[model samples]
Target: MRSEHDPGAFLDRDGVINVDIGYPHRPEDFRFIEGAPEAIRQLNRHGYKVIVVTNQSGVARGLFDEAAVEHFHNHMCAELARHDAFIDAIYMCPYHPDGQVERYRADHPDRKPGPGMILRAQKDYHIDLSRSFMIGDKESDMKAAQAAGVPGYLFKGGNLVNLIELILKQIGRPLER
Candidate 1:
């Protein structure tokens, strides 16, 4: 079915796909969630354009540089590629409310809960919000999805298989497995 609305879903990077260890900018620091690749592969197989919107306050805090973040993404994409899943686009907000760097400081509209990233994806990809859903581990993901008019799924602590099963059911397609 072609959805004239909500053409794709936006995802969070850290806690959603990888283990959130403050700010993971190194390839060695990257750890994929048990079923993240498969889950994303499922989304791709189902024809969902998986996009990632992330908040990298570490850049503002001087914990890491933008190049490190970009490199991190490149490594991440390579890792996911092994599973035949790739994110459509990745939007990151490196600024923080209080940052060491002048440019990195201050609130930015692209931050989660702000809807900037989601809206940009919508405008760029022509997504239908009501038809797409975001799966994330933070409340900010919920707020962002809500603000962008897309459904949100909070990833509470649980088994990976169960989580995917739940998401499928919530989206109205029970996993055949």
Candidate 2:
């Protein structure tokens, strides 16, 4: 049951967190974007639950398996923890309409522009959607947030920390520290 009443920061994994070099399922290839860790840490201090919602179509395309995705998430979490930033939870959709893998060949609602993943995260984290927001590099991310009743911000590169700070300021949420 959803019990906690924390606000969440839904972030896209690819271009938002790390450099999107195609379907990156390996830890060695996961290079964090500039100031990404600090941006998350800032949110942490401001009482926001950091959540990653990504669409991993590579799994359905036969480029990788769910195990690889899990391993990558683990590595990402460990790396973020090292910087005093952490993701409260991660939600990934591996299904695509034209997937090569038969098991994941259907168009899933958890996919971006559908709001399923964000809605699930809201339930799991008991996030206050009214106070939550999403940051992404794609228009689909914005649509997902809108569908979930959360505001969305389009990040067009540069330092993520700066963008995060600006968001916090615009939202008028005072920082704890």
By lDDT, the best candidate is: 2
The CA lDDT of each predicted structure is 0.82, 0.93
Error of 1 at 100 (Å): 1.0
TM-score of 2: 0.96
Candidate 2 pairs with clashing backbones: none
**Candidate 2 — what's its lDDT?**
0.93
Q: CA shift at 143, candidate 2, in angstroms?
A: 0.8
The residue-by-residue lDDT of candidate 1 on 1-177, one tens digit each, is 655553576889888899898889999999998888888887776666688999999999999899999999999999999988888899899989899988899899988889899899888887776667787898999999889888888887554446766766677542222
Candidate 2 least-lDDT 10 residues: 168-177
- The local lDDT score (0 to 100) that residue 79 gets in candidate 1 is 97
Clashes of each: 4, 0
RMSD of each: 2.6, 2.5
Most TM-score-accurate candidate: 2
Task: Estimate TM-scores for all models.
Answer: 0.90, 0.96
